[model samples]
Target: MAGDLGLWGIPVAIVGGAIRVSTPFLFVSLGEVLTERSGRINLGLEGTLVFGAMAGYGTAVLTGSAWAGVLVAALAGVVFGLVHGIICSLPKVNDIAVGIAMMLLGSGLAFYFGKPFIQPTAPDLPAIALGGWSDLPQVQAALNVNVLFLIGLALALVMAWMFRSTKVGLTLRVVGDSTDAARAMGLRPAVIRTLATAAGGAFAGVGGAYLSLYYPGSWNEAISSGQGLMAVALVIFARWNPVACFWAALLFGGAGALGPALQSVGVTKGYYLFYAAPYVLTLGVLIATSSTTRALSGAPGELSITK
Candidate 1:
């Protein structure tokens, strides 16, 4: 029975897929956590993600340096975040509305500019050969992890601690809780939120960099596939905790990888249906946590959605 279904390969493929697929989710969710923690939401991260992919790929193509591409992508995210932050800070401007607009704008710009680089080849990021000790090829393939994934894991731990122990984290929490309270503390809410939003964009950009320079490793318009928008829901599902976001991302990634894993083992029936698992999981998570009577547990007080 163990060998009948290509037993070991199934789990191995799923595990490998989870690690590969979750990097974008991890980065975007972390960025969203930061943005939402500052009492602002940048739904436009979808645009940022797409744009980052293009910029990162184009930079890598031009400079022959994947690292430079990641850096440029991050800068692009900062610019997008700054734009979203500034516009949303205006009186009576709806954050959601501006975010939608930004999404369109970002994607449009990326498509137009990225057209040139679509045919060009870019350097791919190198992976850590963690599976070299494994004698089995399946085990070796599954164990090969990327550096960005490790960095993401380290970031989650640092974020969890920062939220609990740092002055900057506390200040972010304070602003996220109440604008009036933040002002009373002599902190400028607008400035803080703008900066925070930009920082969040930077994270999203790196996530974009990972998508193009690693994983599927290419520049294309359709690369993001709503991961940025979904990260918003992911933030809520994570209860606004960074460490929770990490685990949640892997769960999402695993769900995403289910179809491919099954197909790799000759389970092709209903393959397309399996691809929907992540969306179904996202919907289920939203349904389970959503409440009309009160704010969600761990939600920031000043978030408009909770209000």
Candidate 2:
């Protein structure tokens, strides 16, 4: 017998892991969606993610309220986004370079502040029982989705509506499409980008908060594992659509859980390969979507990366 490879177990494990793993990606992807839609890219989201995790966990431990921790993390993310936006807006300072620098700064800041939270045990986010209908234990566990997961999905839908229907979303898209056009239309490109970056950072911060307060409590050097960076790649894979980011996040989450699921099944031979699935999938998506032959296509036209 190859263990209990029943009809219910594997799917339950995957669904559970996808719900858990998708939290961070959902936040990061959503944040990137906002920033990119405003005609800028924040590579420093990696730093924002780590620092947010540390800040959120530390705050929750101190205040005994996970919500308070989320607030503090969002604030920290705003500050990081402001710094990143301001630096990128300056003449001669490339967005890519600024993003890399912010990543280092964010990671370093997390390491500095995360020392005390390295211990086991901190306040965690509460989960909502959406699977009460299922009598099976596996079904219940799989359906014990976190409140943040629901929030993330809601945010995606709201953002999609905004991007397609709202004035602010229209302005963001216009700014991303052409800076000169924005300037002509009396829109402040710098202000729009700065604000968008801040909003994006806040989202990323929430993602970090989920990591520390929900999925995996406590903090350490390996707390993040490049989830933030992979999120940037995911935004591209999702074609900068928040709704698509949600689905992409779920896919990435499933890929992320493959190794652990295999281990649970008593298979560990290709563990490392499973770990690489998300990145491999991301690269494949990028190659499929991007084309050097067509100049300024697929990506936002005014985006620095494409130019």
RMSD of each: 1.7, 1.9
263: Cα error in model 2, Å: 1.8
For residues 1-307, could you state the per-residue lDDT of candidate 2 as single tens digits? 1125564466677777888999899999999989998999899999999999999999998899999999999999999999899888888888888899999999999999799888846778999987789767667777788999999999999999999999999999999999999999999999999999999999999999999998877678788988888898898888888899999999999988877766665665976578888878877876776776775345788887687
What are the Cα lDDT values of the candidates? 0.89, 0.88
Q: How high is the lDDT of residue 132 in model 2? A: 88
**TM-scores, all models, native as reference:** 0.97, 0.95
Screening candidate 1 with a backbone cut-off below 3 angstroms (N, C-alpha, C), the clashing residue pairs are none
What are the per-residue Cα lDDT tens digits for candidate 1 across 35-78?
99999888999999999999999999999999999999999999
RMSD of 1: 1.7
Q: Candidate 2, residue 249: CA error in Å?
A: 0.4
RMSD score of candidate 2 (Å):
1.9
Candidate 2 clashes between residue pairs 3 or more apart in a chain or in different chains = none
